[model samples]
Target: MEVLSHFVRVSISEYFRNLPVPDSFVGFARLTGTEWLTLLPFVGTVSLLIYVTIQAFKAKPVPEDTKVNRKIQKESSKVVNMVDIEDLGDKVSYCRCWRSKKFPLCDGSHTKHNEETGDNVGPLVLKRKGAA
Candidate 1:
């Protein structure tokens, strides 16, 4: 192990010394300050356009009856589920993550949102009103 480590270290040093690094930034030095200044607005405009297009696509309409909506968030780590209980006694368990402590039911465990960073939405609970 010692011999192998020494050989690897010596080989790496010799390789770098034999083929020294060149001034890779020479290409940038060729461009004047005006060139970079001109490029700044182009880059900013392109970035803004991309951001707007993505945001427009992200806000696409969701149906009233759909149970799950996907690709709504930037990071999209959490799921937004709208469970439909057709019958009076039917049970619905909206599990954002299967790691819920409440098993099939959501115990607010998804608040952590899979440890991802972004805006998150929780499950939707719909209850119809009946006249007594």
Candidate 2:
């Protein structure tokens, strides 16, 4: 492990040493020659390329849970029931743990879910006495 760590440190130092440095910073912090100033353009180009590459590969930020929930509710199927009166037709589907492939309904998907997550969840079925 010590040898591996030493090799990593040496490799990182060599890699950083090869990275472009601004011409103004090439000399010692105390005293320096200005002849390297001509390399400023190359330094800027290298820095810009690095910045763009990093940004391109970065994952997009995720939305907050509340915002995500609101969006999901907007897109999800709705089930409403009427009370105190007889109706001919009404239906309600329950989404067990919101993991249903048939949203708000049971499609035996929970069996697979139980195996994977060790969760004991089941769907609820609702029926209305009358229709709207």
Candidate 3:
């Protein structure tokens, strides 16, 4: 193991030493005013494209039915309702269809919606541990 390690280290050092080195390094400092000006538009375009791509990926998706009717305007607001688990019973049925009179809670309104639209949308039923 020691011999193999020494051989590898020697081989790497020899390989690097045999590599050709440039007499002068090309950098921004070596560029003329004309060259810098020519590169500015290309750099700006690439930067703009990168920024737009990042923003597109970071953006959250908006739902198609975001515009609610005046009747359920308050219920369809951006504000989140915080429900206390202690206040709730063992089992709860949350509304999947927007026609619920109780807003978040299911009041069998999806049945009427299903009958009207011929859709099979139902409630999001939640059950607590060991609650029959």
What are the TM-scores, per candidate, against the unseen true structure? 0.25, 0.31, 0.43
lDDT for model 2, on a 0 to 1 scale? 0.60
Best by TM-score: 3
Ranking by lDDT: 3, 2, 1
The superposed Cα distance between candidate 2 and the true structure at residue 82, in angstroms, equals 11
| Candidate 2 residue-wise lDDT, 1-132, digit = tens | 999898789976775675445458534353424423534555678899999999999998884642312323565376443434253237654656556666645677677767976878777767765633
TM-score of candidate 3 versus the correct structure, residues matched by position:
0.43
Off by over 4 Å in 3: 1-70, 75-79
lDDT tens digits, residues 1-132, model 3?
A: 988898789975675564343346656667677766766766688799999999988968896655433245566446355789887789998877778888788999999888976889999888889998
- TM-score of model 1 relative to the true fold? 0.25
The superposed Cα distance between candidate 2 and the true structure at residue 126, in angstroms, equals: 17
> Which is the winner by lDDT between candidate 2 and candidate 3?
3
Candidate lDDT scores, in order, read 0.57, 0.60, 0.74
Each candidate's root-mean-square deviation in Å? 17.5, 11.2, 12.3
